[model samples]
Target chain A: MKAVYKRELNSYLNNPMGYVFLGIFVLFFSVIFCYINLYSLVSSNISYTFSYMIYAMLVLMPLLTMRLMSEEKAQKTDQLLLTAPVKASSIILGKFFAAMTLVLLALVFTLPHIVILVIQGNPGFLVTLLAYIGFILYSSVYVSIGIFISSLTENQVISAVLTFAIFMGLLALEILFVPGIQSPTLYKILSGISFASRYSDFSMGVFNLTSLVYYASAAFLFLFFTVRVTEKRRWA
Target chain B: MIEISNLTKSFGKHKVLDNITFRVGEGEVLGFLGANGAGKSTTMNIITGYLSSNEGKVLINGINILEEPEKAKKLIGYLPEQPPLYLNMTVSEYLDFVYQLKGIKLNEKAEKGEKSEKQQHIEEICEMCGITGVYKRLIGNLSKGYRQRVGLAQALIGNPEVLILDEPTVGLDPVQIIEIRNLIRELGKKHTVILSSHILSEVSAICEKVIIIHNGRIAAASVTDKLIKEFQDSNRLRLTAEGDAQELVKTVSVIYGVDSVEIDETKTNSSAAEIIIRTSKDVRGPIMSRLVEKNIGVINFGLDTVSLEDIFLKYVGGESDEGSIQERAE
Candidate 1:
């Protein structure tokens, strides 16, 4: 697992994709940060910056995870991993953590905004920490879904497009279904399962345990599916 | 060092391997001879634990591959038809990654040596595979031969007891083919080797034992020389002479000990005719004397040695009739 992790991380660091991802992430983040805090002067809460960043993540996270498994399959390098004396779960987790590490590094680049806020105006430390945690958890779910889609096909473009489509669907579930459902009970269920509604609590400075478990379990379920997909390919 | 029993595999409704069984002893070089899509790679994949068999088990050095893949896989190394290489990585980095991925560990006592044991081990493998000069270069920049050598180097890491190579010399030039064949021969002295190829001379040159697979079945299996000898029992003689083609066949068919006589259409023309005679005994002197009496000048005459190509065709091109083939083998 450690060997796979190191190789995957180095693959990202050696290529231009890692820097490209960081560049786009920081670029959009700065734009959002400026408009939310500097232009409007709406509030001193940093969580507002994170809330808007989730929309940017819908397009950016796929860049990091699209080639994670699909490239291995397209290049026939998966034979090396599958034939090695390692478990399938270990290979999946190794790639998952590597992408997550890059996302965390991108999140670290946002710390300067918090510092600038502290210098000029008062900001709540606990609220900022909770918001960062919420972003990390949300990104984990996105990364897992991206990787799971990657394992399904060998074409990186298809993997990226499908992942982006799924993220968009998950984010707009309530809005897409609001007009179709007439019953109040069915409407409640649709909004309840929506990722946007669950994430709204975190952006509002509320540490909701149910939302935490929902995100963690959603991430775990996709990772488990990735493992099963790799194992099933052997039989195929 | 390896045993496979009653292996069967199917892709959807089409069966690829059917009740195949074979074994390789310690330090033996076995060759799998088959045409394209004859299930050669499938068998190798199953032995290396890369693919699962529907109704069979592979045991590598007494460890079941399906039941204990980690332990069984640790004892064997596999090189697929396409070498699984990361083009973005340098040769040294790729080897180091494979070394760690295989979970090879040096002795605790060797940890206190002058240089790190892992580095020394990888360097030694590179030297053996003749890739030391390109160690720092990226795999993408290397030539095809160098890429193949790097692939071979990765398979040699940890010095596994058994090596399974699927067409190791495919797409190489003649010189490179010979070089890789010599390398496999050298490695076979220390490890049990199983290699697959559709090239007849390659199996006859390197492998001690050969198994010919045709249409997902074991067509024949025996020691290489013994298999060739078994099919070469009936002697064939090629006689080239300046005579009428029809009259030559008529005269040769009546000779004693000659089972049949056929005009070699490819080498025969109006002036000189080449006749192939299948005989159970030496009739060279009788044929020359008879032809001299008929005023026909003998241009060339020699015994034609039956090559592995003939045997391969006899087994693969014939009908799917195992009973006749078995009787001929006996």
Candidate 2:
């Protein structure tokens, strides 16, 4: 697992994909931070920045995870991994953690904004910490989902497009369905399952255990599915 | 140290391998000979634990591949038809990654006085595969032959006991093919080697035993020299003499042990005629003396050695619809 992780991380760092992902993410992150907090609202509430960053993730997270597994398949390099004395789960987790490490690095780039907020005006430290935690958990779910989609196809473009479409579908469910539902029971269920709604608590300075478990389990479920997909392809 | 028993595999509705079984003893070089799409790659994949078989088990040093893949796979090395290389990585980095991936552990106490064990091991493999000069270069920048050598180097890492190579010399030039064949032969001295190739001469050149696969079934299997000898029981001789075509055929047909004699119409002319004689025994002495006695000037007379191509065709040509065999023969 460590070997695969090191190789994957080195691959990402050696290629242009990692730079492009980090560049696009930091570019959008700064633009959203400047426009939402510094220029227009002049508010020190960093939670709003974290809240708006989800939109950027919908477009950029696929960049990090699209080629994770699909490139291995397309290049026929998976044969080396599969035939090695390693488990399929180890390969999946190695790639997953590598991508997550890059995501964490991108998140680290956002720390300057928090520093600027602290220097320019008073900002709640606990709320900012909670927002960072929320973003990591939120990105975990999408990263796992993107990796699951990647394992399904050998084409990187197809993997990216499918992951983007699924992210859009989930976003549409949160924005269009939860508020527009007529029945209270239906609204309760939809809101319970909605990723954005669960994230709203974190953005509002509330550490919701249910939302935490929801994201954690969702990420685990998708990673488990990715492992199963790889194993099934061997049998196939 | 490899045993495969009753292995069967199918891809959906189409069966790819049917009840195939073979074994390779320690330090033996075995060749899997077959045409394209003959389930050679499928069988190798199953043995390496890269693919699962439908109804069989592969035992690597007595450990079932499917039941204990990690332990079994640790004892084997595989090189697929297309070498699985990361183009973005240099040869050194790629080899290091594989060294780690294979989880090879060396005795630290023995190697403490010398260069690190991993470095020495990798260096030896690089030298053996002749890729030491390109160690620092990216795999993408290397030539095809270098890439192939690098692939072979990776397979040699950790000094696995069994090495399974799928068409190791495919797409190489004649010189490179011979070089790789020699390398495989050298490696076969200490490792159990199983290589697949459709070329007849390659099997005869490197492998001691040959298993001919046709349409997912074992068509024939035997020691390479014995197999060729088995098919050479009947003698064939081509005779060229300066005589009338009809006179040449009639003179050779009457000799003892000569089953039949036919005039080669293509090469036959008014001056010299070519005749092919098939016999169950050597009749060169009688045919020669009789031809000399008949005042026919003997131009060429020798035993026609039956090549492995004939044996391979005799097995696979019976039911194949492919025209490649005929084209190759011509």
Candidate 3:
């Protein structure tokens, strides 16, 4: 398992995919920081930068997850992993972690914003930290989304489009969770499923256990589902 | 050692493989021979734990691939129909990644101030595959033959007890084919090798036991010599001589064990004829002495040859409508 993880991580580094993803990601944060943090005379709410950073991930997460499994299936390279002396969970987790690491690498670039705020003026330390947690949670869901869509097709373009559609749908589901609907009980249940509710809670510095469990379990459920999908393919 | 028993695989309503069984002993070379789409790839996939067979099992050294895939897989290395490689990585990096994926706990094997043992293994594999010169080059930039060599090198790494290669030399040049064949022959001394190819000549030349598959069924399986002798044209003797070709033909007919005779149509002369003697017996010894006493000018002689290609075509190609008609009548 360590062997697969090491190799997967190094391939991402050597392939320059890590660089491209990090480059575009840092560029998003910088552009946001310049407009919100640099141009503005008053700099109190720097944590809001991450809310804008969500748009960056809307484009970057698809790029990160697009080639993850689809390329392996396309090149037949998955055979190596499938035939290797390792558990299937290890291979899937190894990929998920590598992609998560790339997103985390992008998340770290926002740290300098907090540092600049500390030097120039006082900012809420807890809110900025909450935003980082939210960033990781949201990207984790995206990783799972990317992997599930990737397993469905061999074409990278199709995988990317499908992942984007899934992310957009999940985002829209959060907005349309009207309390006036038939049953308020079902509305609460449906709202918990939305990634927006999960991330918004974290970004607001309220670490609700339901939101935490929802985000973590949603990622786990999707990863487990992706594994089952790929495993089922061998028979189909 | 590898054992495949009663292996049956079906794709929905289409039965692609039907109760196929074979075994490979250590230090032996086994070849799977068939026409295109003979389920060769499917069989390899099942054995390597890449695909699950619906009604069969593959055991590698007593470990069932389905039940304990990781343990069974550790005993085998498989090169599928296409070399599974990350085109983005260099040759060395790709091998390193493969080595790492195999999980070598070699902290003790690493030397100080040098690359890890994984890197060393990758370098050695690159050297063995003759890709040392291009070790730093991306796999995408390499030619087809180089890609194949890289695939073989991956299979050879970790020194597994069994190597399963599907059409390893499919699109290679003659020299590359011979080189890959020689490598397999060398690897045969220490490991069990099972390679599949539609080309009958390669299987005949490189393998000891040949399994000919047709329509997803085992059509023929035996030693090469036995198969040829059992199916192809009957053995015949050839003798070229200068004489009255008609009388030469008639005289040889009277000899015991002589099945048939024919005179060469490209005549040497009108008065004296050049002839070919065909006999059931490979009797060049007694026939040559008798012919020498008759003053017949002895020229050339040998036994008729049957290539594996001939047998392969007859087996798989027999699925044609005309053959089915003939089979129905029989």
Q: Best-fitting candidate, measured by lDDT?
A: 2
Greater-DockQ candidate between 1 and 2: 2
> Which stretches of model 3 miss by more than 4 angstroms?
A15-17, A34-43, A176-183, B107-123, B229-235, B238-256, B262-282, B285-300, B317-330
Error of 2 at B327 (Å): 19
Candidate 1, residues B9-113, lDDT tens digits: the string is: 998877789999999999999999987778899999899888999998899998999889899989988898889999999998999899889989975244554
Q: Write the per-residue lDDT of candidate 3 for residues A1-236, one digit (tens) a residue.
A: 56655666776788677788899988988888878777863665565677777767877888888887888899999898898888778788888998887777777776777778888887787777777777788789889889888988999999999888877776666666454567878887787566776677776677777776777888999899888987887787
Per-prediction CA RMSD (Å)? 4.5, 3.1, 4.1
How well is each residue in A1-236 modelled by candidate 1, as lDDT tens digits?
A: 88898999999899999999999999999999999987786666888888889999999988999999999999888988988988889999999999999999999999999898898888888888888899999999999999999999999999999999999987776557664798999888887777777777888889999999999999999999999999898798
Candidate number of the best DockQ: 2
- Distance (Å) between predicted and true CA of A194, model 3? 1.4
Q: Model 3 interface RMSD, in angstroms? A: 1.3
10 residues in a row with least lDDT, candidate 2 chain A? A43-52
Instruction: Say what the RMSD of model 3 is.
Output: 4.1
Put the candidates in DockQ order, highest first.
2, 1, 3
Residue pairs of candidate 2 with colliding backbone atoms: none
Task: For candidate 2, write residues B91-186 as lDDT tens digits.
Answer: 999999999899988653445468877788999999988899999999999998888888888889999999999989877789889888999999
Report how closely model 2 matches the true complex, as a DockQ value: 0.86
Local error of candidate 2 at B74, Å?
A: 0.7
Candidate 1 chain B lowest-lDDT run of ten = B319-328
Sorted into a CAPRI-style docking class, model 3 comes out as medium
Clashing pairs in 1: none
